[model samples]
Target: MENEMRSANTEPLHKPLGSSRTFPHFEGLLFSPVQLVKKSLADDVPVDIETKIGPHARRPLKLSMPIMISAMGYGVALSKSFSIALARGTAMAGTAFNTGQGPVLKEHRDNAKFMVVQYHGAFWRPTVHQLGQADMIEIRLGQGANAGAGTVVKVTDLPPDVLADFLATTHEMVDKPLKELVVPPGIPEIRTQSDLRQLIHHLRLAGHGVPIAVKLAASNYLETEMEMALRAGADVIVIDGAQAGTHGSPAILVDDFGLPTLAALCRADDYLRLNRRRDHVSLVVSGRIRTPGDMLKALALGADAVYIASAALFATAHKQVLKPLPFEPPTQIAWVNGTHASDFSIDEGADSLARFLTSSSEELKSGIRALGKRSLREVDRSDLVAWDSEVARITGLPLV
Candidate 1:
């Protein structure tokens, strides 16, 4: 009877309709594996720091500082502004930066010391050629802010200069109004297991010999997915937590599906360790990693390095003076009942990000000194403690 029930449950889940335009549904919403993992664990620990992925490696990625600016993507953050901010900030504090998806602006590549270029689409220059340009190649399966939903892009996210550059490149007619910016999702054919294997091969074959990292949201059976990634040649895996913020995402998908950052880290670590590939790859955590304390906590919970995004933007924001947007009117569209917010004072937005980058970097460096660590790699689980392990246990975590 158990086998019979299991068999029944294994049937094709909400098969896609025969019609191209028609969609299918299980219960009118997307099905997620988070609901199952949430119910299975117990004894969650606040400090389960244990080196798991690529454990036997000689040295881990010695991120100068414990923090990084998680790439919010090209269209989400003004062209190259975020990267420039990181270059200055990371150089000051010492850390890595992510080259987010979307159009790869030239300026983003200019100053990046340790840039992780994300392969978002089929069109991305394969990692083989990009190895010299980036230290790490992060495979973005999904983001915590949206899980497997969509990438956020509004005209307001681009700087006037960048938009001008883009316009010239595409040769499309004229000014895009603040209210009429059409953020088109770049069409790509690179979202499959095979696609990942090819990219991994590219990274390994690159002249610079960069390590490849695959990123995923805590939306499904992560243990299962991560194992596949390891088998597919992943040198590192990034598990983005739900608390990770974004310019915008559909409320349902954003709020639903995926474990919080801490929870996902625990599961992924356990899986990698148990699989006996701990030394073969590494685990990095991301999503709202603002302070040294946050990075400290994540490391104590088994993350090799904690990635950040919003925090970096805070460092690079322009001080007070905002740049005005040239686009007269920006177009907007509603996706999944979610209205788009497009304010085109692009310069103002850039100014804020540039200023933010500076401030946040200083704050992070202070935290590192307080911890008595000269570099990010020196800070470990032993240097920190979880203040709320009991509360974590209440969430059904597997206590050590």
Candidate 2:
């Protein structure tokens, strides 16, 4: 069906949704549960699932669970109401929400408990006040979906209010209104390791001692990139694998570029361990990490935490999607420029997403207890075995 649609058109087939391509993920890796060898924790026993990012920084970004809402920009990826609902939902879950490559909305700040703002390659950068309000700062080097590709937003497609907000925060002077806004492939200011270090340092000062994170697309050069980020004094490293989703991107980049989440995590873990910096820097992995089991597998494979986007979006809409069913796509109610976006209920979306996070967190605790572990940090590669020989070789786990 997708191929037919592609063949029908000459222009690149753009999905208004995430990448549909499947990648080798954690499905082959199974948890080695304890029973006779090691007594499992009783159902009544407590488990600690709390996570801290950038523990070595002046102030770490703390979460009640190891799950976070990945960057979904407002006014570009999601409607204002949807963005605020995400903020409220993450706050309810006692987790963190990230502001993607869009202008920061004050409503998000007001509702969010912990907000991580992305310093993107766009001309409209976050202001000092916005940076100061962030719980953490993520330097967007690249993402899983588009890799280093830039973004183009047609002015006519955006809501008037959103367009106004973007123009207001733009760093460059515009004598006339722009027909389209273009986000460059990479930060124009950063061309070398020294440039990155300076930017991180400046962001640290602007963020008022908040943890500084460097987000990168998973690639073959993962170690070299990690080294550069480490030298730049990054407190946290976020790896978004090829399996990650996006609002929209070229099919070529989505299907062919970047490494799979499983491979990226292993390589990143090995690099950090080899340099003895694993304990000093926090590592967060994201790319098709939907279920609690996937989250557990990622943590076991050496990720300190995981991020979720499509799952969170679906959870937010949940049954509300039925409202647009049989007539228009569900995204019509959630997208920033969605036709039915105004009809989206913020309260309901927030409640649904909060419940999803809470439920996922509880399931994680159950998995931990089944492994005879009481803490998330206790589950490591030792607790995992690969069902596939190739997976075992990649993860260095015993093949079952």
- Judged by lDDT, which candidate is best? 2
lDDT for each residue of candidate 2 in 211-309, tens digit (9 for 90 to 100): 999999999989999999999999999999998988888887888899998999999999999999999999999999999999999999999999999
Candidate 1 C-alpha lDDT tens digits along 269-362:
7787788865577788886566545665566456776777655554354331222223321112101111222322334544454445445445
* Candidate 2 regions with alpha-carbon error over 4 angstroms: 3-10
lDDT of each: 0.53, 0.91
Tell me each candidate's TM-score.
0.63, 0.98
Global lDDT of model 2: 0.91
RMSD of 1: 13.0
Model 1, backbone clash pairs (residues 3+ apart or across chains), number: 48
Scored by lDDT, model 1 comes in at 0.53
Question: How many steric clashes between backbone atoms does each model show?
Answer: 48, 0
